[model samples]
Target: MITLQLAWRNLWRHRRRTWLTASAIAFATTLLVFMITLQLGAYDMMIDTSLRVFTGQLQVQRQGYHAKPQMRATVPDAQALAARLRAASGLDGVAARAQGFALASSVSRSYGVPVIGVEPEFEARVSTLPHLIKQGRYLSSDQAQEAVLGAALARNLKLQIGDELTLLGSGKDGSIAATIVPVVGIFESGNPELDRHLVQLPLKTFQEVFTMGDDAHAIVVSGPSHEAIPQTQATVAAQLAPGSGLVVLDWEQLIPGLRQLIQADMVQNWITYIALILIVTLSIMNTFLMSVLERTREFGIMLALGSSPWRIGVIVLLESVYLTLLGLGIGLLLGGGIAVYLHYEGFTFPGMAEIYAQFGLPGVIHPKLSFAGFTLGPAVIFVFTVLAALYPALRIRKLQPVEAIHAV
Candidate 1:
């Protein structure tokens, strides 16, 4: 208790210097928390948007379908697999879809586009397409020879609600056939590639047109939560027959490009965080060394009065702990205040917004807070402080009392 009091007093003896060091640590902590929160939040948003817009938590496809996605490479037991996946625990919904490239044309214009055939109710349970309709209405479950066009595709073809468009493509026998489909709706996803290429129609319509009844290119499954994806995938995989010749892929594997991008960002953030910690550590070490040099005579006097080297070391460590704790407290308050403000208002980058919009990313970014941010920031600061004090404490043990006392 006595040693603690002495240490506390020593920390406050030079209030300005101690406060400066503490403020530096606090500022570092605040920046780290804010930056990391923003990075993680952006990553989370990207994954969520991608999942909602296209891929679900997991997908099951024929063994070689992913490598060469074509109308012919569809799962033969798609209906049975979808039923098994839908029945699995931790799964929210499962839907089967067939995808292919086709030429869509009006009398005035013609363009090649990607077509997706889906079961309306099952698709609504798994994806956000139902909510993304911008004009007219989504395709009804009973609607036959109906199609939905993306905004860009509609504009290019000069199409509107109730317009009849001719879709020409090769059927299962590789013979070219054409069907007239009434456009039911137009959707805009803010993704140029998707918006310009995608068109949706009823699964039955596709089956009749492509001559592939009860077959699908893939079965998309949504889990109750992201954390449950792996477990749900396992359950669904186990339900499949031994020779079904299907492969189940998780979101990360299905979207390797997006996963790689997130990983790269995380790596960059870690490097920046390490650099900041090193800078702060160096600054604190220099300050502690200077303090020990200035207080040599005082330390010698205390030693002469029966203060042990161990007590001197404890005092230095205690001083570091006190400053670190104070800094951490201030840092958490400041960082929390900023994060709360940003979480509500969001941050917008003007010119960058358009660039990101082209890639289907939102203009505004929200900050996120987690238990790790609240706890780990202070813990790291405290560890850095203790480490910085080690050299100065060792210097105190090497001092001879008489020489140290008389030198200055």
Candidate 2:
């Protein structure tokens, strides 16, 4: 306790210098916490949006359908398979969809588009599409001749709600299929490709138009949260027969591109963290070394009065501990305050939605202020600060009393 008191007094004796060093550590900690929190938050949003936009947590597709995605390569009796999957344990929702590419034409313009047919009520439970309606209304199960267009698609085609558009595509049986449907909704998917080239129609109408009978290209399944995905996938896999020709895939398998992007972000964040530790280590070393040099004569006096060299060294380390603790306190308070504000208010980057959309990320980013981010930065600072004090403390032990006292 006496040694601690001496160390504490020593730290405050040079209040301006001590505080300045503390401030540098504090600023670095704040930046580390904020940047890491933002990266984590952005990753969370990307995973969620990518999953909810279309893929869900898992999907049941015909063996080659995902790779080829042709009308002929579909799950036979898809409605029955969907029903069986829906009754499985740990699954939250199941939506069967028949998807294809078609050319959409209006009186004044034409554009090639990707089209998907879904059962409105079932799809609503599995996808975010129903909630993304920008103009007009979402599709209804009873509306067989109605379709929804992506916002950009509608604009390019010069179509609007209640406007008629003609679609032309190849049917499942190798026959030409054509139909005209009224636009019921326009949605902004926050994905550039989807918003520019996707369309939605009623599942029954899609099957009829494509001459697919009761087949669907994919059945998307979801759980209440990400934690339930593995269990839900295992249950679905076990339910399938040996020769079913159906395969279940998790989000990571379905969206490898987005997964790879997150991995890259993690690597970059780690590099930044290592750099922060190096910077803090150097700063603490410089400050504590200067203090040791300036107090050499005092240390010499203590040595001459029979103070132990080890005890004097310990006091130097304690001073560093004090600085580190003070800096951690200040940094956490500041970083946590900003994190909370970002968590609630969110940060919007205008004109970046399209750029982020290319990678399937959302424009608005909301940082999550969790315990991990709150503690990690300060913990690293504390460790490096102690390490930084070691050299100065050892120097105190090697000091010769006569030489140190007579030094200028």
Candidate 3:
């Protein structure tokens, strides 16, 4: 306790230098906290936007369907399975979906695309497509032979609302499948895969046309948010009967390359953070070195009076500890407050609202302040600060009392 007091008093002797160094530390920490938390929030938004547009947060499918999607591989009794999963997962949004590849034809043009089947009312719980309709309306019944087409696909086939579109494909039973449905609606999802190649029909219509026998290829799921999906997915997976030949896939698995993209961006962020911390570390090191040089005679006099050289070195290190703790404490209070505000109130970029509207995403981005975000920055700074003090503290070991005392 006495040593700690001595170190604290020493800091005040060079009050201006200490304040400047501490201010630098606080500023750097604040920036790190805000940027890292903001970055995490942006990632959450990106995943939510991409999933809600069509893929959903989780999907239950045949074990091998995702690896090699064949029209014949399917989950039997889709609505019943969806109900069971919904009850077990405690998720509000669970919809059975059927999919098949077909060639769509209009009077003058034709294109090959994936045809999906959805339950109209249940689909709205899991998808934003019903809300993205730019023309006409979404399917109103489970058995409607009407279809909704993507904007790009409609343009490719020269199709418009109320136009008769014909679908041709091989059903699950290896028989010829044919259907003609009126285009009731068209959607622009802002996702190329969805916009360019997706076609939707009532689940019943798809089953009948695709010979799927009341079964669906996938069961779509939506949780309250992306963060809650893992728990929901685990609950759903556990409730499935053993050897059910089914698997639950989360957003990371459903969306290709998304995790890799986030990880790559995080690496870039850490690199920038490291560079900033290095600058702060160098500044603190300069302070410690100057303080040691200015107090050389005092240290020498103490040594001559029977104080060990190691004790003087210990004091220098303790001074570093005191300064670091002070700076870290103030930095965390300011930075953490900023992060908390962002997490709650959210923030909007100047013109992002319009862009969000175009993409059907929420206008504001909320930062997710996690434990990692809270500690990672401060921890790194503390470690670097200790390392910086080492150099100046070690110089005391090489000092000779007579030489140090007579030095100008």
> What's every prediction's RMSD, in angstroms?
4.1, 4.7, 1.9
List runs of model 2 lying over 4 Å from the truth.
Answer: 1-16, 63-68, 89-92, 107-109, 235-245, 260-282, 297-318, 337-366, 390-406
Q: For residues 303-369, could you state the per-residue lDDT of candidate 3 as single tens digits?
A: 8998888988888999988888888888888888999997899878899889888889888888778
Report the lDDT of model 3 for residue 385: 90
- In Å, residue 405's CA in model 1 sits off its true spot by 3.7
- Model 2 clash count equals 0
* Per-residue alpha-carbon lDDT of candidate 1 for residues 141-222, written as tens digits (9 for 90 to 100): 7237799989899999999999998899887667765689999999887777778888998887887787777788889987
Give Cα distance to truth, residue 357, candidate 1, Å.
Answer: 11
Model 2: per-residue Cα lDDT over 1-408, one tens digit each:
868999999999888988999998889888878877877788878788778887788888888777777777788888788888888754547989999878899999988888898989888878887788889998888347999988899999999999998999888898987899999999987777888998998988998988889888888997556667788888888878889888998888888998899999888888878797788889889999999999999999988988888999999999999999888888888888888899898877778767766444666788867777788778878888999999999998889999888767
RMSD of 1: 4.1
Q: What is the lDDT of residue 370 in candidate 1?
A: 71
Q: Please give the CA lDDT of all the candidate structures.
A: 0.81, 0.85, 0.89
Off by over 4 Å in 1: 1-9, 90-92, 173-177, 267-279, 299-318, 333-371, 379-387, 390-403
lDDT of candidate 1 vs native? 0.81
Ranking by lDDT: 3, 2, 1
TM-score of 3: 0.94
Q: Candidate 2: give the clashing pairs.
A: none
Stronger candidate by lDDT (1 vs 3):
3
Weakest 10 consecutive residues of candidate 3 by summed lDDT: 223-232
